[model samples]
Target chain A: MHLRTPLPPRPRPARTTRRPLKHRARVLLLALCTIGATILVSAPSAQAYAPVEIVHTEQVQVGPYHLTVGFSKWPLRAMQSLDFTFAPDGGLTGKSGILSMTGPGMQGGMHMGGPLSRHPRKRDVWGLDVRSLSTAGQWSFTFTINGPHGQGTGTLDNITILAQPGPPLALSWTLCTLPVIGLIAFLVVAWRRHRPSRHLTVVGI
Target chain B: MDSVHAPTLTGPGQPSPPDHPPRPQPAGAAGAYTVLAGTLMSLVGVSWDVQWHVDVGPDTFFTLSHLMLYCGSAIAGIASLVMVLRATFAGRVGRPADPTVGGSPVRVFGGTFTAPLGYLVAGTGAALFLLYGLMDLWWHSLYGFDAVLNSPPHVALFISISLTMVGSVIVFAAARAQRWGRIGLVVSIPVLITFTPITTNAFNGVSPAIDPQLAGTVLFAVCFILMGGITLRRRGVALSIAAVLGVMQLFLWWFSPWAAKAYAAHVGLPLRDNLRHMPPQLPSGIPMFMLAAALVIEALLRLGRRRGWSGRWLPQLTGAVGGVVLSFSMLVQTSMLRGGAGAGPMGPSTTSATTVLTDAILGLAFGALAGYLAARFAVLLHLNAPATDQEGR
Candidate 1:
């Protein structure tokens, strides 16, 4: 048998006085920094956006301007974000345009409109980055352009919106069966190896 | 000599002193409850996430629903870890080791760590889920957006979550055999909720055209019948549980859409334009049928017990009957509601009589097979066994 050995006592901790003012100042600084960082991070992404796929593109003439308009994705689903670009033949040197959109789900005749800017990388391209479509149905987008010559409006109507895609066939089937397979395998192994040995004594039987 | 004379018995008829005081009723297993809560949270999160996807399209990995899902996983993982640690190191902390607190620990990883089997299983599942979450993020990045539900990463995640649910069931089953058995029934709420998604996958709201309603009905009927047979044992209790589950489903059918709408509004997320005009997806009529099926099974079991009928074929037989009942009920309900409440642009429009009949026949056959399989599996896993003080001893 081994004899027990005693250990030395632990040292007491030193006490310190609280500094309220310093703590308050530090907390205030931290809060401000956090808010500033959040805004800085979120601002750029909010302004410039692009769609996942480019579905449709067409050219139309309005007054002195010849414009090409593109819809980011086809058979659009509700709440999908996509880019709407208008490229003019002349250029967007001293010119600007407004893209006004109206759809089925809009509340009480309200239309969403935003200013289009010249593309940062491309010449003669001006576009409005639309965040999302609120509903699935026919939608109309009217682009009103103002240039040195005059103002002209071009409308793209009857754009069809479809429902979102359903579950992928192969993946869904495999996922549904995977757990069943696991259950079967576990049961099979347990039955072969452990069942007889613990048949009667195991609880809850 | 004086001591011996003084040590006389009170009387021959008097009862002797007890050897030891009766053990205090075992404490409610906190870990079991934690796991249950986590499971429920995960189910809700998944449902909301799906709605969000339908309404708002593809989003980043850091969405609110994803947070809720991961939070559930984290809770289960942490709770399991704590329980394992407490069980393994209780003696080191100058306390008498209590096996009942977290059940018994199994030596694993070449005897490196001693942990309760349920906890170990759950922890492994949690780890797998986290890994799959990362995989899902990578997959989304590579493939753009998976508009489909059954992506590879999602399947992995589902498998992991199922393992966690099974582990939770095993843990509570052990508790149910002891004085703390009542908690098992409580835990069943979350278990049922978690399993509901899996059993109903064949007839998910997204696939209205598929006439696999019969397959879904058979699957759940067999599952619920087995659950009733193994867990409740009493006819009235089983019936009550089935009724409660049905009521709960009805409530969820209404609550889910409302909750999704409320959440979307709160988060400033957009809703599908047509959804505002369209009715919500109809609740699968399985729960009501399950109640009827449970009653039938209870009656049969009682009859069999009185008649000294062989117990071997009972589950298979019950399953077959339950399947038939469920299929017929679903067919009738679908036929009645076909165009009125059942018709959604997203749902299948056709409900022909021929299809219903064929599905019913198939359901009956599958149900019997499922019933037999469930019985064998339950026995192998000791799922229906009574709780005992010592587990592997």
Candidate 2:
């Protein structure tokens, strides 16, 4: 008796082929391309900071509150006494405070002149309680700079205060545990083997 | 053809068998190892260099947890890349392709080009963001971008990343149509990460009106979801890592208040004053929960490695399980440590336990559901790695 045979399913089309470039040639091309691209992307940004002027902003994080003194072209560390207040808006209710400033000569930039006159003195930097930041807005601080040169007045604007905490959960422990568990498992297995091997040696009958 | 076919006869055969099935050829294990190594390195560079740590308590997004997030990525990326590249080259030497691994003969071009293009986009983005961050920092500290520490690094990172991306793309395109197509796709993620803006709002000063913590949490959650989905499609160690991330996110969110309080109390920081600076409260108890879920998925994917399963599926499974377990445990530990006045400078409030438990449960549920959904979707979408018999040459 003759049996009928079933035909096989049609095969999928073969993948197209190409003569791949040599690895060395490709690497060289890649390097050259990357260099050319880098030059294009970075040239503009580099030009933006050409004059190399220093911009300074004084900021202090006391407790949960943030007090930014604002941006200035000149160094205000030379000022002896500073006083500032906040207008009622969001959180602070006409709250004001004072901070005394004394520190080593401010480093970086020759804009501040020489060693502050060898005179021993305590400087008053302005302060604010900032007990609460209920409102989200800017605060202004006006400083009366009483430097030896003369009395200069400067205003600091839009000192923003962000209220937040660190990330609630931490995964460091978990990461650390991978090795720890492996180590512990290793130790446990080693102990089990060593103990049996050492204690179970057959004694002379 | 005759010379190549002559070696199979084991002996000076009395009668050579008519159709001796091609001798089971030795598989390309070395290539596999190289790809794995390359993937690990790439993972490290992307995670650490591109996305630096942001410190926020439970109120924020899922916890990044020091530098590990970056470190792990670097390890995974570099390792995978190395293994894949080596494997690709191994074919040149006439090594037999492993039956399980070399399914669906993809033209090297599409595979290579797409992957590198993705990386170029991502890497360039990250480099730009890094520059932005540096500028922001300079703005914060120096009031401008002139300082040496601040500006030069910014310039360097930006230029370097751009260059790297460009090279990466070229390599990808050049290597396109090779077996490294899938691997290239994976490596391109860091390049993508480079583009995402981690900070915003410059006119209003550096401080964000949008709580970074909250934003971060959401960002991590979204990443976790994507990761879970990716794992389902790829089916490997990556999923296990995702699971761990999800659990960790849950633990952090649930126990954030306590952890914050503990840190504050331990360090003698005031609670009301601190929370005041942050965004208004949300219902989220644990920001890290979602992250934990991601980690767990990744961990579980990795487990397949131990079971003699070597393929796309192992990474997702091992990654999912491991990530979740680690994240959850850490959360619990942190919460407990930070819960009481005696323990630290901060005092524990009523919301501590409730928040933590809720986060834990939610994380667990979400993680499980995500894993299930990912698996289901993979089947539905026909994303399964092609079997050798069905794979096209």
Number of the predicted model whose DockQ against the real structure is largest: 1
Positional deviation of B130 in candidate 2, in angstroms? 13
Weakest 10 consecutive residues of candidate 1 chain B by summed lDDT: B1-10
Give me the runs in candidate 1 sitting further than 4 Å from their true place: A1-184, A196-205, B1-28, B55-58, B90-104, B178-180, B186-217, B276-288, B340-349, B381-393
Candidate number of the best TM-score: 1
Q: Candidate 1's error at A154, in angstroms?
A: 20
Each prediction's RMSD to truth: 14.3, 19.4
Residue B140's lDDT within candidate 2 is 25
TM-score of chain A of each: 0.50, 0.23
Candidate 1 lDDT by residue in tens digits, A1-205: 9998997885332224433333543563465456445534543432322233447887777667788876666546665445556787777776777778898867787798666754322334665333456567888887888999889888888877765344554664565456557666755655665453233222123
What tens-digit string does per-residue lDDT give for candidate 2 at A38-108?
A: 54454344332122122454654433344444222332322111122222122333333333221232235
Q: Could you give candidate 1's per-residue lDDT for residues B331-358 as a string of tens digits?
A: 6555554543546433454556776777
Model 2, position B53, has a per-residue lDDT of 13
DockQ of 1: 0.06
